[model samples]
Structures are given as C-alpha cells and as structure tokens.
Target chain A: MSKGRIIVIDDEDIVLISCQRALAPEGYDVRIVKSGMDGLKMLESEAFDLVLTDLKMPDIDGIEVLRIVKGKWPSVEVIIITGYQTVETAVKAMKLGAFDYIEKPFTPEQILSVVKNAIAHRASE
Target chain B: MKTKVKKTLYSLTGKLILTIGAMMIVGSITFWYFLIYYQERELLKNSVKYSLSFVDYVKKSTRYGMLTFQQLLIQQTVEAIGSAEGIMRVRIFDSKGKVAYSSKKEEIGTILGKNDPLCRSCHSESVKPRDMQSWSIRRDPEGYRILNIVQPIYNEPACYTSYCHVHPKEQRVLGLVESDVSLSLLDKAMKRQKIAITAFVFGFICLISVVLCTILWNLVSTPVSILTQGMERVAAGELDYTVRIDTRDEMGELARAFNAMTADLSKAKKELIEWGNTLEKKVEEKTEAIRKAHEQLIHSEKLASLGRMAAGVAHEINSPLTGIVTFGHLLLKKFPEGSQEREDIEVIIEQANRCSSIIKGLLGFARATSAEKSSANINDILNSSLNMVRHKADFFNIKIVLNLDESLPSIRADASQIQQVFLNMIINAADAMDGKGTLTLSTRKVVENGNPFAEIEFNDTGHGVSEENIPKLFEPFFTTKPVGKGTGLGLAVSHGIIQDHGGKIFVKSTLGEGTSFFVRLPFYEEKA
Candidate 1:
C-alpha cells in the first residue's frame, strides 16, 4: 500500500521545519506549509490522508482547516497542535470533528502515535 | 471654676490697679482743683485789699491836705496863704456872690455870678453856707481847684445864727475860701502802685502754675508712663514683664501688683504648656494601645480559624479512612486471592481507590499549597462552588438564585482558591438559612473608593446574626450552630483567602431576617 500523505501547517518556519523533519523519517510522505492559505491551496490540488495544523496562525487557524478538511474531503483526518491548552479550545476542536489534539513540545513518539491512530481510524471509516 | 478663678485673678490685679490709679487720679485732680481755686481766691482777695488800702491812703492824704488848707484859710487865708508849702492860689468869696479878695489880681473885682452853680449855692437868698463846707472844680488851665470852708459871719459872737437873719439889710455875710492844687503827683503815685501790685500778682500766679506742672509731670506722669509700657508688654504676651517704680506711695503699690500678676501669668502659662504636652502624650499612648488591641483581635481570630480548619481537615480525613477500612474488610471477607472470587475483590479494589482520591483531596486541603493565579472567569468559580455544594443544597431544600453579570471582566486570582472561597460562602449562606429559605448570589464589576473591582454578593434568608454578634461574624470558631454541626472556620478562612488576594469581604445582617455578604476582588490588567 502507498504511504499516507500528511500536511503540516504552522506560522513559524522553525515549527514547520521541525514537524516536517520529525515526520519525514517515520515513513509518511510529509508536506509543509507556512501559511494557512498555502495549506488550503495545497489541499485543493492534492489528496492528503491526514493534516496536522497549529491552532493559532495567520489567515486561517487549525480549527478552520479542520472544518474545511471535513467538509470538502471527509475521508481526511485532522489533528490540532498548540502550545497552550484550554478546556474551551479542546471542546471547540472536538466539536469540529478534529481527530485528536497534541500539545506543542510533544515527543516524536507521541506525534507519531496520534497520527497513526488518526490514519487507522480514518481507514476504518 | 476656671472662669471664677480667672475673674478673681483679674479682679485682684485689674480692679485693684484700676481703682488705685483712679483714686490717685481723682485725688490729685481734687487736690489740684481746690488748691488752685482757694489759692486764686486768696490771691485775688489780697490784691483787692492791697489796692483798696493803697487807694484809701491816697484819699486820706488828699483829705488831710484839704483839711490843712481849710485851717490855713480859717486862720489867715488871704495873705498868709503865700507862706504855705505848695499852695498856688487862694481866694475868698462873699455871700453877695462877689469875689471879695483874690490871689490873682485879675479875679479881685470879679463877681461870682449866679450863672455859676457853685456861686448860686452860696449866694442864694436862703443859702446856708455851713452846709456847703467844701467843693472842688477843674480850672480852665486843667488845674484842680478846691473850694472850702464856707463860714457864716454872725451878728453875735457865738450865736448859731441863721443865714437869713445874719444877712439882713447891712447884715453880716459868710465868705468862701477857694484853693487850687495840682493832682499830677498823686496821679503818678497811684499809677505806680497799681502797676507794682499787678506785676506781683501775675508773677506769683505764673510761678505757681510752673511749679505745679513740673511736680505733676515728675511725680505722677512719669511713673504712669512706665506702668503703661509694662502693661503693654504684658498684653503682648510677655508674661514676665514687670514695672520698676521707686515711689513709696500708691504708684509703687501698683508696680508691685503688676509684677505679681506677671509672675502668676508666667506660672499659669508654664502649667498650661505642661498640661498640653501631657495630654498629647496620653492621647498618643491611648491610640497605640487601641491599635495593638485591634491587631491582637485580628491575630486571635486567625488562630481560631486555624484551629477550626484543622478540625475540619481531621474530620474529612477520618471519613475517607473509615471508608478504606470498611472496603478492605469486605474484600477480605468475600474472597481470597487467585480464585474466581478475585473478580469481586477487584471491584472492592476500585472502591478502595475512590477512598484514596478523597484522602488526596483532604491532603490538598491540609497542605494549603500556593495557588497558581491566572485570569479566570468568575462564573466558572461560582459554578464549581455550586456544584460542590449542590448535594447539600438539595438535601436542605434551599433554592439558590444567581444574578450574575455576563460581561464581568476576569480577575487575576488562583482559580481553586477563589473556588474554595465561593464554596465556603455558599455553604455559609445555606447553613444560615437553616436549609430552607432562598439564597441569592450575584456578581458585578464596580468601582469602590476609586478602585475598580469585581463584586460578588451572597444573600441568604436566614435567622440572622444579632447586632452584638455581627462584628464577630468573621471571627474563627464563632458559630451559631449546634455544638458539633459547624466548625466556624468557613467564614474566617474565606475572609483570609479573599484578603490575601487583595480583596475584602463585608457582612450585613439583621436578626431574624437575613444576612448579606459582599466580596470585592481586584481586576486583572493585561500588559500590551
């Protein structure tokens, strides 16, 4: 089977580069977008199995990305990544059909586990 | 008494001094008036007597001169008059009104005419020459002429003859002698005497006035001026001012009294200053004592709150331990390990885990860990506190009304500490209502004393605290509950917690009506 395609969006270049490097060696075909609009454009042109996006970003945040992914491509799973965690934010992400949430400064293993779980769950669906 | 004392002192100095001064002034004035009046009267009387006596001497001298002239005329008037010392002219006139003989040859044949009133008197048909003894007139040349000694020539030697009988046809006639004397010398002497007496009286009065004025200035006015200056200094608040008067009379007494008054005033001022300083010190000591007592009350309240909290924590821990002990006993009785009955033991183990969690909560309460502060919504704290007390609220059948403000700004505080304060307040409100009446909770943002704060109010329809107990409501272990039902640390702990967060709590209660507690917390400012 072909490896799943994952898109990571972050406003910070360092975060985008680090996420891409962490997930690239994990056998997933990882793509990076610095801005929310670029991530959306990439989503419209290609197929992504999963999208991991920062909650707070310019133009479109992780929540909007999750909404669009669910609306246009229901098969793609989305997860939220943020440095600060709050109950209201978690509840909002869950309401928007985000697969799960992972806090920033998360270990490589934690990221991989959540992404795998989201992919397996999406396949099952 | 103070006014009386002041009046007495004032009278002793003021009245005595004034009276002495007034008496001295009045006595001096009377003495001067009488002395001037009597002395002037005596001087005037003496001047009048001297003038009158001097004029009498001049008149007596003129009368004597006239009497000697008449005697000379009577003795040898016509020719012997030339031997007189100062005589100028003499003449004799007959009863027929004719100049019989004259010192001036021109007047020898001249008839004294009836047109002359003096001749008419002597030459009248019924004239009595003895009644016309002496007469004087001014001559044409401004010389004084004296007419004297009109005598009757009688028919018999010593017969008191009537003029009509003696002067019958070819009868004897009386004759008159006239003499002229210059009066300029007498006039000059009278004028000189008058000038001398006038000069003497004026000089004496002037000398007396000068001497009296000098004595008054030296004896009275100088000492009085010194007294006035000393009094002015004393009036200007120089309490030690004294006057030096050397006189041994009334003015000296006045100076002594003035010195005494100044000494008394100085003593009084010193006493007043000492009293004022002592009063200030006493007030300061009283204020410090009150401050210390207030602090002690607050400290005692804190200690009482601590004791009650320790008891409550002990109670809370005991409950969980009882639960753990009971669960462990049931598990052991039900089954041994490694058997099918182990399944039931697992369930017992889960119940035991729940008891451990409750013990952890008790530990957290006991430890009183520092709160992590953040900007938190007030409603969330209220809701959590309500949730914690909801079971007790339902058990007591109390209805709670929330009038929370929706747009209240978040406060910077420890969320859990705020939750604990809210929980204690609500439980206190529910307990105050005795489990039945309504409890109202409200929140709003308000400004107090020019500072912005979040205000939370909890009101309960309960048997309220008495007026005497209202001040002690926040005191720890001060409860209105039955002996074992309440620890009384709830409100006290709430007070400390809110105060630690830079907030304040106030309670208002009416007996048998209700109680309301207002809590104010500061707002959080976010830095840009």
Candidate 2:
C-alpha cells in the first residue's frame, strides 16, 4: 500500500508536477490536477487522505474547493499553496478548517515534510 | 454717568439757550431802562406845564387886587388859590422886593431881597424884566416838594391910567406873584409807575427768553442730538440706526447724509463678514486637500523606492529559486547519505530557502497600497489580530490585557490590511519583550482636529525601543532584534498599509518602561 493518498491542484504545471514528484518517492500515492475543478472531480471519483491546492486557479478558486472538500470529506486534510499576493487569503483559508499552508517557491523536502506530518496527523485522528 | 451729565450741560442746546437768553435779558433791561427814563422826563415836563398855568391864573387874579390897592383882596386871592389842590403857598412880591401879600400869615409882612431864594426866581439879575416869569422846585422844611412860580405884573395902559398909578407914563412897574405847589402826590404816582413798569418788563423778558429757547432747541439742539445719538450708535457697531430729523434745514440734510453713511457701513460690514466666513471655509477645504495630496505623495514615493527595485528582482529570483530548491532537493537524493556532493547540494538548497523567505518579505514591502476598503470595526480587527498572535504570545509568556471599547465606530478600511498592521505591532512588542511581558490591546473612539476616528492601541510592557532608534523603526531592514529573529519589514509594511487606509500610526516608548503604538483610522461617513 502507498504511504498515503494525496491530490495536488495548481494552475501552474511546474507546481503541480513538482508536488507529485516530490511526494511520490516519499511513499505517498500522489495525484496531480491542473485546475481546482479537475481536483474536485478527482476527489469525488476517488478517496484521498490530503489535498494540496493552489489558491488562484483558472476554473474555480482554491477556497471554494477547500470548502466543498471539508464539507463533504471532513476527515480529509487540505494544505493551501499561496504566492506572495495570496498569502493573506491563505491565512483566511486556515480559519476555514484548512490544515496548514505552504508559500510558493517552496522546496521538495519542505512539501514532503509537511505532507508526512499531515498524513500522520490524519491517521492519528 | 458724570460725563454724560456734563456733556448735556454743555451740549448745543444748553449753549444756544444760554447765549440767546442772555442776549434777550440784556436787550429787555436796556429797553426797560430807556422807557423808565422817558416816562420820568414826561412826568417832569407835565409838572412844569401845570406850574406855569397856575402862575398865570394867580397873576391874573391878583392883578385886579393889586391895581385897586386892596391888600386884603389880594391876600384873600393868593390864599384862595393856595388852598386849591396841589398848591402849597402863593404870595405876591411888590416891585420893591417886599412881600405885599402872603398865603402864610407869618410871611405877610416879610421883606425879601432880590438875591433871596424866594425872590431870586424873578430877580436873580437886578431888576431884569425878562426874569419876571420863572418856575423853581424846592423842598420845604416840612419835607414837602414844592414848585415855585413867579409872574411879574407889568403896568398896562389901564394900570397907568388908574388912580393907583405912581410913575410917569413911560415907567414899567411890576410885582411878582409866586406860587408853591406840593409835589408829594406826583412823587407817589411816579414811584408806582416805576415799580409797575419794572415788573412788566421783567415778565416780558421771561416770555421772550422762553420763545427764543424753544426756537433754538428745535432748530439746532434736537436735530443735532439725533445726529449725535445716531453717530454714537454707529460707532458702537449698530450701523442700522438712522437719525430721524424732519426739518428741511441744514440739520436735516446732515441727518440724511448720516443715515446714508450708516447704510453703506452696514452693507460693507455684511460683505466683510461674508468674506470672512467664505475665507475660513476655503482655507479648511484647501488644507484638507493638501493633506490628502501630501499623503498620496508619501505613499507613492515609498512605493516607488521599494517597488522599483523589488519587482523584477523578486520575480526573477522567485522563478529560479523554485527550480533551484526543488531540483536541488531532487539532486541531493542522488548522492550518498554522508557524501560531500550531497552536503554541497544541501548548502545550495539551504541558501535558496533563505532567499525565498527574504523575497517574500521584500515583496510585501514593495506591494501596492491599494487596499480594498470596507466598513470595518477597529475592535473586531484588534480581536482578530490578537487571535493570530495568541499562540506566539503564550509561547513567549506574554499576558495580554484587553481594554476594548464596545462603542467604537466602524472605519472605512481594508479589514485584512488593518489586522495585518495590528499583527505587525503586536509581534514587534512581543519580540521587544524578549519572551516575558504583558501587552494591553485596546480600541476606543477618538476625535482629532474635529474628525472622528477609531483608535487601536497596543501597549507593551517590553524592553522598550530607545529614543535614538524610534525614528528608524518603520524603515525596511531596520530592526533592533537579532538578525534571524526578525525580517525587519513588519513595521515598514504596517506603516504603508495604515497610510493606505487613510490612517496614522504613532509610537511612544521609554528605554525600560514600555512602548505604546497607536493606530488611528477615520470613522466612515456614509454621505455620497
């Protein structure tokens, strides 16, 4: 079995591909989507332990995705990916039951470490 | 009050009445004196005329008696005439200057010289016939005023032809008939005339004085007083007052002119007050506009300095830093757990991480100041900001005291940015305290310069900032904390955010006592 099931959503290819590449080797089953809409469709079709979503997306925003996911899958953890412009919104996301947030230009290890912790926390819960 | 009374005493009316009354008094006294003198002269002339008539009548009566040599008849005639009213004594003096007959029995046989007072009326010159007719007045020893008239009897043809003739035909012989009339009654009448005329003249003078005073008061004093009162009212700033003088003289003309001047003054004063009010309003508007412009300039200048350098550099570094950190982590896995190449990749990744964090700070400092403003309560913002800092505060052993005012009004501001600014101030206070202090968070209403504002204050019992460093506290990259403990951009970003929201930040600190940072935002007004 994979360490944990994860979905990464981003409008940027580099951020989405990097999150999947960084977390897959760490034994977490990583899923990637380019938009918040595709990420939500993926969540409805499958089961996931955590969701990492970019705040600004082409179709639907990260906050709406977060709300729908937390309302539907209360056990699933959500991590927001924010740039400098969206950092304040990321904090607001935290108030909406998001687990944590990671700023842009983050390293692979940084994403791995946060994912490991979030997965471990979900398992404990 | 005394000056007013004195002013009235010496007023135009007083002076005019005094002058005219004095003139009238002087004229009336002069006229009265002239009239009394003329009356007295007429009375004396009447006395002289009556005395001459009495002397003629006595001479005619005594002529027959003297020519017939009837001494008793002549004496009886002189006595009978003397007994008439206003007659004192009557006598006849013979041509030899002897008393031939007398009304007084003691003087019947008395002889008188030509130089005697009784004979001197007709005999002052020795036997001068022209002196035969004369009148004189004297006071007797009994205190009676007497008029003495002497008539000389001339020898007519009948007298010379009579048996009593004692001289040749050409001789002129005469005897004097002297009459003394009592003047006591005329004296009494003259005295009564003097007193009556004097009283009448005094009353006439008084009436003339009344008429003159009334005329002068009407002509000069009343109009002048009205003008004076009007001038005083205008001087006292009552320009609406008018002098009402209905006369068609110079005084009335002056009053009309005075009223016109006052009207002009009132108009000028109204215009001046209007200008003053407009000037005050204009000054306030200009000052408010200038203040807004100055704030805009400061915000723009701050943004230009940081944004100009921070934009491309941060973006360029951010794009590459993502690749460097992500790939560097991916490449680190290629080396052995303890290899030198792995450590080198780790160093690159570590430094790239540091650059990433710094670029975020720089981005915040260089961000646009366009705040999405809405109606926000300062107390709510303060509470939310406190919630964000509560964990750090508890870790630092900070006890937060809340002194929020429930009645604080809402301000027009970006709620998030305002909360961010508050977060910056709170974090700074916690850092300055070095893990042990109390922070008092408060929100209250304040009015400054007549504009209502909501004030949020963060008072920290921390190792306060020094006076020398207070001015530089809001500058980016200026920090009192240790190098890694702070980014040094919190206060600078906060200052920019507060300014964008039309608010101000003020800080006061003592070296070891405490520090207080106040954020003031104007209360939102709903008028469009």
TM-score of chain A of 1: 0.92
lDDT per residue (tens digit) for residues B1-528 in model 2: 999868866987878777777887888889888988998778778988888888898888877776687878888888888889888788887778778788887887788876787765555665564645777778867665777777777777877787977545675656677778888888778778888888988888888878887888789877877787888889999988888987788998898888899999999999999999999999999999999899768755876688657755775566467667888889988999999999999999888877877787777766647578888878887888878878763435888899989987667888877877887888888877776888898888888999988888899898888898988888778887786667787888888887777788889999899999998888878657
**How many clashes show up in model 1?**
0
Clash pairs, candidate 1, are none
The docking category that best describes candidate 1 is incorrect
CA displacement after TM-score superposition, residue B37 of candidate 1 (Å): 19
Number of the predicted model whose DockQ against the real structure is largest: 2
Residues B19-68, candidate 1: write the lDDT tens digits. 55555556655655565566545744544344334323333333332334
Q: RMSD of model 2, in Å?
A: 15.2
Error of 2 at A37 (Å): 61
Candidate of highest lDDT: 2
Which residue pairs show backbone clashes in model 2? none
What C-alpha lDDT, on a 0 to 100 scale, does residue A119 get in candidate 2?
92
Candidate 2 regions off by >4 Å?
Answer: A1-125, B1-9, B118-132, B139-145, B155-162, B167-173, B210-231, B243-255, B289-528
